[model samples]
Target: MATFIIEGGHQLKGSIQPQGAKNEALQILCAVLLTPETVTIHNIPDIIDVNKLISLLEKLGVKIHKIGSGSYTFKADEVNMKYLESPEFKEDGKGLRGSIMIVGPLLARFGKGYIPKPGGDKIGRRRLDTHFEGFINLGAKFRYNREDHFYGVEADRLKGAYMLLDEASVTGTANIVMAAVLAEGTTTIYNAACEPYLQQLCKMLNRMGAKISGVGSNMLRIEGVDSLGGTDHKMLPDMIEIGSWIGLAAMTKSELTIKNVSWDDLGQIPDVFRKLGITIERKGEDIYIPAHKEGYEIQSYIDGSILTVADAPWPGFTPDLLSIVLVIATQARGAVLVHQKMFESRLFFVDKLIDMGAKIILCDPHRATVIGHDFKSSLKATTMTSPDIRAGVSLLIAALSAKGSSTIHNIEQIDRGYERIDERLRAIGAKITRVN
Candidate 1:
């Protein structure tokens, strides 16, 4: 129950550093269950989701030490419990979507895992078919109660096998990889979601002694080991948040320097944003965004005049940022279509933007056409509530660029990606304040 009240129409100055990827942090935390040794994770974001996952781990008998600021040492040397199906554990676990990833790991290491229906954002239908299907492939038995919405899992020493996931799910891949690392034999996963988050999971596992090949590809091979050892790993920067900041800087005409961004891992984001006429400069590992950037119009291909940014499995524009990009396109010099094919109902938030006087055509559940308004901060400000992570950030950008002061409630949605966003924006001269 916190709200951000913002006074808009300010050319922001100064610099901001992106937080550690929350998505990656959750997966790495779940990987700790794979070993009985101490695993030190650095650059952990102090977001609610990470805190929830850490709370879950502590409940399961993991010993967590506060080594330093933004770092922790987690030792789950004695995993006293494998089943969590009560109302308390259910309420806590249901608060975040990333908890579902524990299913595969718990089944691989412990023989059984009890998970209730996991919840996160209210974007659309969050499916777990790929996750449960992968676990089934690895010899785990699963049962779901429709009335109770409880999903239970059980497996005995998961045997290695090949699984061709129906879709490239990021968490699904992480879950399967965590399970296969300790299985009896080799496991080959094809059409896997190879996002940087999953890459960090694999790297952390390998550091703990799991033999994993093809770190950033659709195909992954994991050679099951007897046990994983203790290791230290630092999570990568939040590329989605970085992209959001880049969009914010361009729209609001701000100059910013984002520190500790893993440039090597941001494979297609720069080029993709460049297609929309935003230029980014990399000074070593940090990214510099200039002021009043002339964000370009969408470029069309040789085949057609329409340019579309769609979400694929990975190595494509992330589905998580489609809403943000759509919002950014509202101020660009041209019209671009964003197709969120992965989730059918993700485009529902566009109506709120349309209400804010932006031009948008909701073609269907999967497609939307956004026409840039080139709107200067107007004199009118409105009250808005966040829907999901990407839309929430996009709305925050809108509020920051709007004419007057506005209020955005339920900002915890935005906090999932952007760490201490109000504070970070304040550093860059954004007039934002968080209030109870």
Candidate 2:
């Protein structure tokens, strides 16, 4: 097992850049299956989840070549879409949630696809019925194998129709969108999960000649085409990483500038943090963070009531960053309710911060209020293991700014999203070491 030994209390002093978005990368990789030409994707993060997905693609005869750092050229010509039936495929698919994306391209290319129950952070009930149902609406047949805990679906050719998802599930929406892009006739996805990740996928599909409108809205209209050709694309910068770095710099009392951020994509984030008294200055494509901005105060409402930070779908605060926002709020002045409606288990990480001498109220599984900017004297270092990706990175930030030395195990979870986090953090004066 690997663990990160971090000695806290030193303010980070340098700049760091995060890799591309993992969520977008997963979908983009699978979108390659829609074409038989060489598709090049730039700024691909070398994370485990991506590697697993790439491995699956390779097993199915998708020839992938490393063009340069954080870039790949994928050729899906002569790809065997039948690898979905292999035992190894089922095992790999069950271990990662992104594997569900295969259903879309497979159903489009081979008229059938099989996937086991997808696995990811055990945060709450994530249903794939919406995905299968969307396919069924497009005239696909689905069968469940309870013995193997898998799903088998096939169709002569998917004919697109209207699809209203049960919820705005991220991966589910992406899967259905991919299927509809090449299906016959026009498709409309209402109440879709149009996060930046999904928007990137939409833009990429459009670039590949799939007609999709409503890039950042709830309703997406896709004109299904006969076939999609290859395209060169660079993923937008990671918004979650940018937000995390903002939180980390504020918590550790550092001055840093995050460059290459897509300012247009980060709607409501600056204003959201301004409510918490965090000052952010934007210069062109870069955002500058104030050094030692520890007096982050929670602004009251127009009626002078305490502010509340909650997560909703896109154009609202993202559920993925709720944990980091909660962690940062622990060091901000005043109090705010951090409501995470998407996942029940996301709030469970409060125990680690509570152990760090921070004042936190665990209201329940979905809500918590953080009273901040008041450190309870000394915070003795302790050992903790990461549970999930976002919570894991938030804990790492907390450990880096806390007093004394702390050990964080299960760093694999953190690596699943963030690329070369230790090196990036170290470049910014964070004292972290990986030990076997």
Candidate 3:
């Protein structure tokens, strides 16, 4: 495994651009299978999970071409349908959680789709019931192989119907929308996830001849079309990465400019950090975070109660950035409560921060109360291992602000999300190195 050796207490400068959204790339890449025409996609981030999904599509007979640094063209003119049932496919499909999305387009156009039990971060239990249940509601037959732990859906032709989702899952909503776009009649989905990722998918499908309305709302209506065509699409900047950079600047006491952040879509992220007493300035589309040398103070509610930061659906604070928020709070001027409602195991990483002399109380699997050191005490560096992507980046930020050098093992988890992170940090005056 590769590791990162970081020398702490160094301030970073220069501007960094966020990569294309990883979540959106997964959904957009799967949508390419809906048409035989060339679908050109720009701003594709070069990361592990996204690349794995592209390779999986290539093996299934989708013709892929590199157009530029972060651009690609894909055509699904001659997909290998039989490959879905092959042993090689089972092994490949199980490697990425995003691979489950391909089933939607395949079942829509070809009438059959199969996938192995998908694998991803071990933060918590992520059920596939929403995806399968949505397909069943659209007149598809669902079956599971308990011995092999595989899922399959098939139908001669799907007929549209109304569905009220038990939860507003982003991926689940995206999968169902893709299938319903080619069904026999109109489909209405209430309680849908309206995140920017899903909005981009719906807009792209409309350009491809699918009829969809309610682009940025919880209720989505789709009028099925006979077939979809191809179109060009550009993904939005990753908001999660932008939030990480903001937290990094505050923790390390640096002046960092995050370029081309698409501010209008960053709902609630800036205000949440500002509530932590960090200064965030808007310069056109970029976000400028000034050095917090005196340290930041947490804000209390109007009633003078302690502040609580929690995650909810879109237009709410994202759960993915809670780790970053938690890490930065260790050095703030006051206390704050961080509630990670989406995943149970995400807060388990706090023990590592506690080892570095930060004051934190693990309330439960879903909550933690952090008492800020207020920069009067610097964290002492130590050796650690990365458990997941968000947690890995959070640990890296902690090491960067510590007093001495720190070593982090299993950095591959970080690479799965961020593109060339160490190299990017080095450009911004950060003393970080990689070891094989």
Which predicted model would earn the best lDDT? Answer: 3
Worst ten in a row by lDDT for model 2: 373-382
Clash totals for all models, in order? 1, 0, 0
lDDT of each: 0.84, 0.86, 0.96
Where does candidate 1 stray beyond 4 Å? Answer: 293-295, 376-380
Give per-residue lDDT, candidate 1, residue 52. 86
lDDT of 2: 0.86
Query: Where is the poorest 10-residue window by lDDT in model 3?
Result: 288-297
In terms of TM-score, which candidate is strongest? Answer: 3
* Predicted candidate 3 versus true structure: per-residue lDDT over 161-205, tens digit per residue: 999999999999999999999999999999999999899999999
Task: Provide TM-scores for the models.
Answer: 0.96, 0.97, 0.99
Model 3 vs truth, CA RMSD: 0.6
Model 1 per-residue lDDT tens digits across residues 304-392: 68788988877887888788788878888778989999888788988778877788999999999988865542324678898877888
Residue 272 error, candidate 2, Å: 1.7
